[model samples]
Target: MKNTMAEDKIVADKTIATKVIEKLREDIINNRFETGSRITIKEISERYGVSPMPVREAFRTLEGEHLLEINPYKGATVLRIDEQFVRDVYGVLRALECLLYETALDEIDQGVIQKLRCINEQIRAIVDLPYGAAEYVDLNTKFHSTIMEHSKNQKALEMYTHYHEIISTIRKKYIPVPERIRTGIEQHEKLIEALEKKDVLLVKMAVDEHIKSALENFMTQFSQGK
Candidate 1:
């Protein structure tokens, strides 16, 4: 009976901890908490209507994900993102994404191109909506993932997925900025055009430029502390 009771308690704690993690992650990504701001277990527990244990578990998880920092004396704080961090994250993305695109190029067909076009259209449709930034970002991810799926390289795909998750929070942080959305749409169009022409070199060049431009824009935003 004691063993069963302990197991149940563990399960209950895990369930609450999972909920806390999800809510905190969303709030952090959505910029509800400012960078470098301290977050305490008591505050999160009261805010989310959970006990301190669950909030503490969630903090450990977030710290592992690079979303929060656990200080010895100050509790958990949102990590301060810098220009170098932006460059490094995006640089890894560009490297992985370019390799995926190149490997997937010849395997791409008319149907894949059509699918990408539809996703691009969906992205454009949501860009101007008041609450559409998240949806827009999701659709954009789908568009790129579609092309990358053809790579058939399990290791590359896994690496890309990890990198994607890391940068996704960054995207959520800046989702309210419209210029990035607009520029992404333009770059997508160019990439699709290159694919239609069956010009692999052109596709590579376009992707290179797109990633460089995105890095520049992201760094510009980070430097301005926006």
Candidate 2:
């Protein structure tokens, strides 16, 4: 009976840790925790109604993703968004996205195009609605992720997803202004038009321009402390 009870406790501990890790991951990516804010294992345990062990496990997991920085005797804090990190992410993304477009030009099926169109419509509807900063951020991520999904390059897709996760974290800190959102919507519409025409060159140019514009906007906001 003692041994059985110990095994059950271990299983329960693992389950709780997994749940905590997942929740913390989402919170960090969604920017619920501000950069440089301290996150205590005890606080997370209380918030999630779990034991400290699970919360500690969660922190370790997030630390591995560079989303959290853990210091002995000091606890964990959200990682700062570095401009170099953003440049590295976007640099890789541009190359992969361009490659995806080039390869997809020859292989993009009707089904994929239809799915992309559907996502664009959803983004359009979201933009038209009265939304808060958080809603706009979420919609903006969905819009870019949807395009990557149709690229059909598994390695490129994985890298793009990771890059977007980093970008999402940054966006939460400096929410894009309403004007940027409007410009993004217009750019999305134009990209869709380019896709419809099956013009890979046009699609690549539009994507690169859109990413560059976003990077510039982010830098401007960072400088202004918005």
Candidate 3:
């Protein structure tokens, strides 16, 4: 009975920690919390209506994810992000994405190719709708993942998934830029054409150009302090 009770406690603590981690991650990514601002267990617990222990545990996890900077005396502060951060993350993403495209194209069937087209259309349909940014981002991610899903490089796929967590929030910030959307959708069309032709060179080039455009857009936003 004592062992069971201990197990239950462990599970409960884990659950609380997970919830706290998720909340903190979203708030941090959305810039709801001030970057470089210090946070403490007591204060975060009070605001989140959770206990101090789980908040403490969540801090460790966020720190591992590079979203938090924890110190012995200063407690924790939100990690500051800048253009270099964007360039580094997107740069790694570009290489992985291009490789995924190279490996995935030969195996991708017409059905998946059609699905990509439909997703691109879905992305293009909402350029004028400001509320659609989140949905647009989702569709865009789906469009890429649908293709990457075909790649046989399990290791690269795993790495891309890990890296995407860092890039995904950064991406959502730039989706509201209409030019990015317009250019992205056009590039997606070009990408699909390349895929159909089995032109690996064109596909890789398209991936490079697409990611570069996104990097440029992200840099533009970061410079404007938005």
| Candidate 3 clashes between residue pairs 3 or more apart in a chain or in different chains | none
Candidate 2 ranges beyond 4 A from true positions: 1-80, 107-115, 125-128
TM-score of each: 0.66, 0.61, 0.76
Predicted candidate 1 versus true structure: per-residue lDDT over 1-226, tens digit per residue? 1122222232344578876776677677656788888988887777777789988888988887677989876789897656676678788888887788878888889999999999988888888889777787678778898998899677988988866776776665564456778888899999999887878788888888889987787677666665
lDDT of 3 by residue, 128-162 (tens): 78766777778888999999999989899988886
Where model 3 places Cα greater than 4 Å from the true spot, the runs are 1-18, 41-46, 50-57, 129-134, 171-175
User: How big is the positional error of residue 43 in model 3, measured in Å on the Cα after superposition?
Assistant: 4.2
- Candidates 1 and 3 compared: the better one by TM-score is 3
Candidate order (TM-score):
3, 1, 2
User: What is the C-alpha lDDT profile of model 2 across 1-226, one tens digit per residue?
Assistant: 1122222232344588876776676666555678888978877776667789988888887787677999887789898656665677678778887877665665556776676677656665666466644576776666666566666688877776666665665565676676787787788777777777889889988889888888888878766763
Instruction: Give the CA lDDT, 0 to 100, for residue 94 in model 3.
Output: 91
For candidate 1, the lDDT comes to 0.78
User: Candidates ranked by lDDT, best first?
Assistant: 3, 1, 2
lDDT of 3: 0.81
RMSD of each: 7.5, 7.8, 7.0
